[model samples]
Target: MSILAALTPAPTTNETEWSVGDLAAALRRTLEDAFGHVRLRGEISGYRGQHGSGHAYFSLKDGTARIDAVVWKGTFNRLRQKPKEGLEVVATGRITTFAGKSSYQIVIESLEPAGIGAWMALLEERKRVLAAEGLFAPEAKRPIPYLPGVVGIVTSPTGAVIRDILHRLEDRFPRHVLVWPVRVQGEGAAEEVAAAIRGFNALTPGGPIPRPDLLIVARGGGSIEDLWAFNEEVVVRAAFAGTIPLISAVGHETDTTLIDHVSDRRAPTPTGAAEMAVPVRTDLMAQVDDLARRQGGAILRKLERERTDLRALLRAMPDADAFLAAKRQRLDLAEARLRPALAGNAGAYRARFGQVIERLSRHPPALALARARARLAAIDHRPRTAMVHGLARRADAVAALGRLLGSLGYRAVLARGYALVRDEDGLPLRGVAGLAPGQRLRVEFADGTATVRTEDGGPLAGTEPAPRTPRRAPRRAAKPADPAGAGTGEAAGEAAAGDPARGRRAAKAEGAPEDTPAARQGSLF
Candidate 1:
């Protein structure tokens, strides 16, 4: 065989050719078989709807990837809340290629909202509409009583949410719970919730049903759409307008709904709502005990203090005899303090008083006088003898006294027919320094008064008057040498003379007189 014939096959005249559509269809069937139960998660875009059948078609996309998605009437019927633009969702379906159209589409069985972004958008829209009608207002939310009599529960009867709440309520609080079971999701869920709430309201007084003190609308955890029934406008309006207080407990701890904001109270979960509904029995018992103890302790302490005060008053009281006894005790205590000094001086005081009486009796002045009279009677009896004796002795004493007094003062000399010279006033002109020759002065004598002239030209001529000399001799007579001679003395005779001029002249020649300047007189000199 040639080299070309060995490598190449014989060509046929006519052969069947498959179209692009046919090829795609075959591949699509294989894909459906492989991934029919698969799920896809992405942001929906370019959404389209079939008119009457409730079918929706949209594309799921990422930054660099895309997938076609569709939700048929059955799945759409179960959606409690409709989807919107820019919503993130998870579509559970199989990826299958359409061979006839040469395109792939996701056969979605169910759909759910994806993230907090979409959930928050639904929440905000619900809030805006419900808030305008006063659903989230303080006036619309009814206050929950601290201890409720009966609580109405609107939740799934078979869910863990209901079991947890029941267990918690009975464990912590034992209030009665009446269940109002309802579908918490899918189509018509919002209306079911509203109907249940309205039913509770109708059961109030003057009706054929029992009225509950409070209502708790609760559910278990899921995605946002699972809790979307509580976020519905129907549920929000019913919660606000209901007569009883409503508490919304939906989803997990992190989830929030429009019902939560509008209801009287919101709990993180259904169990939390039950816990809030009633008070714990154990705690109430403890409170009662504590109050009883406090009241008892306060009363006991008051009684104890009163008892102690009464006892102290009784001990501090005074009896009738206390006054007399107190005075006697005080006298005894005083004597005890003074007893040492009194005991040592008692004998001495008696003896000293006796000696004083004896002395007074023996040394009486009358006794001395009697003795003196006896001595005089013993003397010679002569009248002249007594007088001569007395006179002679008096004369001797008078002579001595005269000499002594003369040395002591010059008053006696002035008294002996002498006058004291002075200026025109009675002031003595003691020196030529102050004397004027034509100035007339008085000479004072013991017997008479004479006027004398002052020598002119000295301090007295040019200036005011000079100070007076103070002779200052006392006029008292000197004491006699003997006691019997005093009245008969020559010194007494000279003192009676009163002459002063001789004394004045003698003093004038003896230098300048040391005298104080005279004081100015009101009368002229």
Candidate 2:
């Protein structure tokens, strides 16, 4: 055979030509069949976190070689040891080829630290990480409540740890315990435990299920693998972030866990945690009774001492009658002198009365008083009369001025037969010159005002004049007079404006207002 023919295998009847997808699928099946299950030891690499789908995508890398790896959501959640970057783990799964990526990957069903050394190294690394975040700081630890009303326990309900804690608590102090049952070990145990811790804290105070004041995360004695859940970073973080004070009691006394370091208190056993949660009720009651006894005894002794002091003070005081004897003698002496002193006072008063009467007889105060009263009455009457006369004169003058003003004001003049004509601007029209055809004028009559217009542009706007008999001599009609100006008392060199004839009336008058410019002086009343 030729070298090419020897190197190549001949095609079978079932497999003649393979498409790309068919070839890839065939390869994937072959790989699965070849390595159905295997253990791989490699350091995890390029792991950020789980994807949104809950599947983890990372790679298993040795010193010089690497291979893609994946954990399905189901298997990932059930993983006892979660994958982390740079963690050397022994992954057990089947090797397979993904046709879409044209790459081979291991579908890890289970994973664990490779050995004791690997686990210790990972634990130390996690501890350092959490410590750097201050989760394990001493200052962050909370003080456990002295007497908590509610105690929340995070543990397996079926375990002896809970029973032991209950018994111990009953022996010490009975409290309302809220048991949040969670798996103590195995897959997903850490998550359940952490969730239980957070769940206890999420409770609202005074709610149906009250919020616990203290939290006890307890488990029976176990191997490191069995106790690993309490050491999980989630559990530690949940305990540290919780507002309730937490006591960690995982494994035996010698077995230390990460939760122990982060918890507010640590116990050697479950029973120890219960004891730390509350004090002995009987002991407390006894102490209170003792204090009451001591207080009562002290008060009695104080009362006794005060009573003795009061007795001593009373013995040192003088008798009541002896203290009042001198006062009684002084009272008697004052009583004896009172009547004699009263008689002398009466005699002196009598002498003073006689002297006063003699003085009055020499000069009678009534006559002098009468003169003074008469002078006062005369003085009083004089001013009163003068004031009355002055006020009367003033009133008369005001009345006269009011009468004169009434004669000048427009209200009364409008009552008479006069009519006041004003232009559109409210100014008095004093002459007949501005009267034009179609021009408007306000003629105020005695009753009310009326608007009128001149059609012929004359004073007699709408009337025709009757012919008058021709006069032999044209007699000049008399001109009206001007009233005397204020304080003049007379019109100088002017005749009185005689009243118009009763039988005739003029059509218009010039240089005259119906009344003067002083508006409403006498019209107020």
Quote each prediction's TM-score. 0.46, 0.54
lDDT of each: 0.72, 0.80
Candidate 1 lDDT, tens digit per residue, 1-525?
699898999887676687877777778888888777876778888875554667887789878899877777887766654545567877777788765557889977776677778677767876887678766778666779988877899887887888998899899878877889899987677889899998888884645556889999988888776777888787877887788988889888898888888888999988889888987889988998999999999999999999999999978887658857989899999999788768768868888998988897988878999989998887747766899899987777677555545533434434543345666656754445655568776766556676656445465435765545565432434333344333333344343344444233323223223232221111123
Assess candidate 1 and give its lDDT: 0.72
CA deviation > 4 Å runs, candidate 2: 1-77, 82-108, 346-525
Q: Point out where model 1 deviates above 4 Å.
A: 1-10, 13-25, 48-54, 97-100, 171-173, 182-195, 202-209, 220-229, 251-254, 268-271, 280-525
How many residue pairs clash in all the candidates, one count each? 16, 1
**True lDDT of residue 292, candidate 2:** 100
Q: List the residue pairs that clash in candidate 2.
A: 481-497
> How far is 458's C-alpha from truth in model 2 (Å)?
62
Give model 1's TM-score versus the native structure.
Answer: 0.46
Candidate 2, residues 1-525: lDDT per residue as tens digits?
699899999876864898999899999999999889999999999998999999999999998999999999999978878898888999999999988889999999999898778877877888999999999888998999999999999999996889999998898999999999999888789999999999999999989998999999999887776788887898888888889999999988998889999999999999999999999999999999999999999999999999999999999998899989999999999999999999999999999999999999988999889999999987987888899999987776566445445544565556655557777888866555557778887777667878878565544657554433422211234443323241112211111223322101121111123223221211211
- How many clashing residue pairs, candidate 1? 16
Query: lDDT value for candidate 2?
Result: 0.80
